[model samples]
Structure formats: C-alpha cells, structure tokens
Target: MRKILTPLLTILHRNTCFSVRLAAMALIATLPGATLAQGLFSPAITVNGDAITGYELEQRALLLRVLNAPGNTPELARKALIEDKLKLQAAKAAGIELTPEELKAGMDEFAGRANMSTDALLQALAQENISRQTLRDFVKVNLLWRNYVTARFGARARPTDAEVDRAMGRGGASGGIQVLLSEVIIPITPQTAAQVEALADRIAQVKGYDAFSAAATQYSASNSRADGGRLGWMPLTRLPAPLQSVILGLKKGEVTAPLALPNAVALFQMRGIRETGGSDPSYAKIDYASYLIPGGRSPEALATAQRIIDSTDTCDDLYGIAKDQPPQVLERNERAPRDIPRDVALELSKLDTDETSTALTRNNGQTLVLLMLCGRTAQSIAEASRDQIGNALIEQRLQSFSASQIEQLRADAQILER
Candidate 1:
C-alpha cells in the first residue's frame, strides 16, 4: 500500500517551535541509504493497519522536545510517539479534517502568544534550524487529534440560551458589569508634573463629562486618548481601588478631576453604561458571517480591509468573497453576547430591525475578524429570555460529559513507554 501523506501543520509549543513532518520526510529519504548498512528499520507499533516506525518516533521526538521531557526521558518521548500515532489514527477513524484556514488560525494563535507575526514566527523557527514543513506537520496532527475528540464528544460543546439567561441573572454576562471606558492619560514626567497637575485641576471644572472627555482626547497620552479615553466597562472588582471609587461616585454624564500618580496625572469621564437585559428588546439573536484574518493588523492591512468594506455591503456579497478566501461561516442560532466575542455581541446590541451594524471586531493578536450582524428578533418580553433552570442544568451536563470523554480517551488508549 502507498504511504498516506497529508499537508502538515507546525507544532507551536510554548517554549519552542518545531517542524515534525519535513524531518519525517527527510528521515524517509535517508532511511533508504541507512538500510544499505543496516537491516530494516523496525516499526515501533502497528496503528490500525499502518506501522509507526522508530524513524517516525525520532522525528516526532524532535518536535516534542520543547515540552521539557527530562534528559533521561526517552521513555516519555516513546509514549508521546504512541499517543501521537494513536491520535492520528483516531482522527482518521473519526473522519476529522482541518482546513487550511483553521491551520492558519492555529498557527496565528501560537505566534500571537509569543508576540510574533505569523511570518516572523516561521522565520524564528527556521533560524533555530526547524523547517516550516515540520512545524506544519506538528500542528496538523495535534489539530486532528483535538477534532477527533470533539466530534466524538462535543454535543455538549456550547452553552444554550437558557443558560446564558441565568448568567445574566447572576450579572455574569458582559453588560451586567464590565463598562468599556475611554481615558486620557497625561504623563507626568518630573519636569511636566506641575503643568499636568494644572491641566488636571482645570479638567475637573469642565461641566459635562463629554467636554472633559473631548479635552482629554486632545491631550491625554494614553491609547484611549484618541477615543476620548473611553475604557470599556468592567466590574468594580476588576478596577484598581482608587480608579474604582472615582468612577462609581460619578453619574452618566459626570467627569473627574485629574488625579496624581507616580507616572501620570489620570483624568476620567463616564461615557455611557454597559447594560444587560432590561426594558429594551426582550430577546434577539444575530446570525453573523465572518472572515478571519490572523496576525496583528497593520495600517496597510486595515486600508485593504476598509476597501473590502466599501465595496461589499451585504452578507451575500461577503459570501461571494468567502468562496475565494476559503472563509469560515457559522450560522449560530440566536446567540447571547456572552455566547460570542464581546465586540460582536456589543454590535448586535445596537442594531435596529432590518438594519446592519457598522464594521465591528473580535481580536486576539492572531485572529482578525470582520463580522456582519445579519438579522435579529425583538420579541415580546413575556417570553423575554428562556428559562434558566434547564439551561443551567444543560451546561452542567455538558461539562460533565466533556470530562467523561477525556477520561475515556485516557483509558482506551494503550499508551506505552520506551
């Protein structure tokens, strides 16, 4: 039978990036040469009908090294190889596949945690003498194993509407506590302290928070300065003690005077509030179609995105683009804000019937999303939100179910040591 080969994904470990597959390909080639001197390279174990050989084991070991196996730990390496082999076998058995986009997403996510761009990420590994092909293989195998588990056991993967309602009841959802606030930070260099303090004192005199916020935007040194120092809302518990007290003391349109700090004079204004279920639309769900671009976005990249936005206004047009981009489209049944990325949720909260949202976002250094809130339901409050009692029970069931699946995989596999 022919050897089964597939596209590889690089295994991006926390400490090191290793290529698992290109090394495997290299070994496959040199094994033919080595066999001239020795006998046949023996298979370590038989996976289904296929054999996993010592050469494959060594290659995977090279990829797994960043996991910090001890110096005398050939045994652990051997166990890892078997686990990997079985995982790939299980994935194929379960018919799980990773699309190129998912592979990219996984790669981008790994790179982001390391504070590197995807391209920079590949190069860093190459500098350490690891090939991109090897890294890709590592990522692909792990992803396969992950999908296999989920396909077999993820019916309990997500939360239901009723459960989200209960969370809202407990003030756990985004709007219930977190308030996105903008800030203008005036840096107080030793020389600038007096000037900044004077500015801070004047800021307190401004009548409305908006006037103060506008001035801060013009002069504050913080990142939120451009947006009028608007910090997204947060629970009081999350804030620094002093900052919390000031904001809590103010009302919807209030402004605070500049306060002193070691490094800066910070001024604050209350932009608005983050509210949960109330007298507004009783229940709503937004069906969104997204195009995920991974890696930190650049001005040029955003410019290109702005162009894409200018030309395509409808979801159908976005779909036309997705056909070529190999995009990911998910049609979630009426989702709560807590059920989705906070930014997307906030956008959904602002929509009117038959209306579309302005361009909005969800960002991790790796994942760049362009979301369109397609449709929503503003139903009667009588059935406002679903019953939380059953929903909470369902969530509990799902968690228990996932734990059981992980345990089963642990028990079912014949994981061996060297």
Candidate 2:
C-alpha cells in the first residue's frame, strides 16, 4: 500500500477478523492482554495490556509464509506484525470503521492478485491454523484504518488545482517512458498456460520483446516515463529467441506489435541501438562524457553540461575537463556475490561504454555532465533511476506521515506489544 499522511491525525482503521480473534483468544486463554507467548519460542511475554504470545506472532507470520514472501525471517516478520498492530491501535483511537463486505472485497483482490481462488485462499489460511476468526480480525483493522485515513484526513484530501497543474506540467517524462512489469514465473514448472504466460510477461521485458516497450512504459521503473515505451539500446542475445527475432528485425526506431507466446503477450519499441565491445565489466569503461560545472551558478552547470553535450559531437572533451578542473570519474566495476546486489549486477551485464544510458544521473546542487557508455562488464548493477527515486520518495513520505500519525495515537493508546 502507498504511504499516507493525516491532516487531522487520521488513522486508517484496517481492523480484520485477526484482531477480533486475538481478543477472543486472549479472553478464552485467560492470559494478560500483552502476553504474546504462544506455541513458538520459549514462552511469550505479556506486554502492557495485551499478550505478545508466540502463538500470535506465528499466526501472523504464517500469513506472510503462505504467500511465499521473499527474504522473510522470523524477526523481520515479528517487526512487521508489530507495525501492523501499531496501525490497528492507531485506527481504533481515531474511531475508524470497516464493514465485513469491504473486507471481503479487499481479501478477494489480494487473493486474486496472488492467483489463488477464494477457496484456495481460505484453505491456505486454514493451514496457518489460526482460527478463522483471527483472519476476520486482521481484515477488520485494515479496512478501518483505510476508512479513518479517508475520513479524518479528508480535509487534507485536497490534491489542489495548483498541484494538479504542477503534476501535469511535471508529470509527463519529457524524454522517456517509465515501465512497470509484473511477471509470474513457472519457478521452472513445465509450460502451462498460466505458467507460460507469466514467463512470457517476464521475457517480454528483455529489451526486444513484443510487449517490452509498451507494457513497460506502464510497468517499468525508469525515468523515461513520458515517452510511451522506449528503452536504451540492448545487445542481441540479452533476450530469448522469440524476443531476439523481433528486435533483430526492427529498424533504428520501430514499434513491435504484441507477440503471442505459449503464455504471454508482448509489445515493444526500439528506442535506439549502438555499438558494444569486449570487456569484463562492459560498461565500466565508458565512452560517454558528462558536463560537470561547479555549484556557484546552478543553471550554468546545467547549461554548461548541456553545452558540452551540444557543442561536442562525442566524449572527446571529457579528458579536457579532467585537465581543466577537479574532476572525478566513475568507472563501471565488477564484483562477485556479496560485493553487489544480485539484481544490479545482472542489469550491468547488458550495458557498455559509448552507449547512452539514463544511468549515472544526479543533480545535487552540483553540475552534472554524464558521459554515456563509458564501459561495460558483468559487474555491479546501478541503483534506481531518477524516476524510480521519485516514486520511492513519494512512497517514503506516505509511510512517514502514517508513522507520525501513529505516534500521536500512541500517546492515547492503551497499547502493548511483546
């Protein structure tokens, strides 16, 4: 869920049957409200007025487990549950509300999103072995919290005409398209319709796939968002056979129609193509240059960077800058596992120096002149793009707002977590 801020200290009352069941369990078990002791761990510690039983944590953790959540750990799961409880408590203080039907609707969407039938979803929940009532309580809190946010925060809900106008003017990516991609992998299962399509979706994102550019414009996490579906140049073999065929057949700039596969649909656009060469970290040795002007004159930095780009035909002048001013060069470097994020290293394998990349971009009061395609290798991957950074910032703000609101509620909360 996206982050949210409260105008009137609103809480999203997302109560679920889980909270109710926990309460019921507390009553039936005759334990302190904070005693979280359950079936796991040594024994649960009872918190303020609630029971932070091991049983309870395990029950909540099971929800995450059932979904095969990535990189999950017991402690992380515990922290997440604590955060959820905090949210629930906050919602209650603010008098948030949710109906059973709304909860069911939300559950249905969640279940469907995971590609599970309602019955299957239930069965999975049952495997958690937490009472069905427990699930309901969880749903209850979530709904209530959302309601509270909309209500108490309703006054602050105004997105405003000026904001809207600003968004419009600044929203569209002037140069590129942002892409979002969802993939259902077989996890190596034999090619079934669902499995095949899932892989298809994933494959389609590999540069030259039919749907690569189009769907990516909507799904990709990139700075080139305003452009419909465009990506930087890509090597031929980076894609599978089906995708490679479409890309190889393309002109310098062409849109490929959606290609049907065993299970997926693909659409794409060829933004550009360029030369690549032999290197360990292929992009580490870059040929592209940047326009770095000092921060004394902000616009000049940008202008000078652009001027370097506009005046010079190539990165030939990069050395001149290093000669004239204090300069730093960032080389594409390779590292083994533990040295870099696995995903980043993988992306780096596909790029090279001399190629134009939206990577290596930043403007922190200093002039930025990025040289393209400095070098390449099967090395470290880059971090998020400018657009990715923006989206992330938005999400972070929402969470921070929610956290602050929760803190205010905590002051009045008769809350305890073990």
The numbered model that scores best in TM-score is 2
What digit string (tens of lDDT, one per residue) describes model 1 on residues 1-418?
A: 0011111222233222232322344555565566723332476565444566665555555544443333444555554455556667767777788899999988777667556677876775565445687567666776776666556655665566534533433332233444445555565555666787888888777877678678877876544555666655444433443465687777766766666543456666676665564333234344555555543244554565556667776555766655655435323234643455543453343332223432332332234445555554333322444444445555566546545654565577654322
Tens-digit lDDT track of model 2 for 350-390: 33433332222233323232434333222222332335434
Per-candidate clash tally: 29, 104
> Each candidate's lDDT (Cα)?
0.53, 0.44
Candidate 2 to truth, TM: 0.36
TM-score of each: 0.34, 0.36
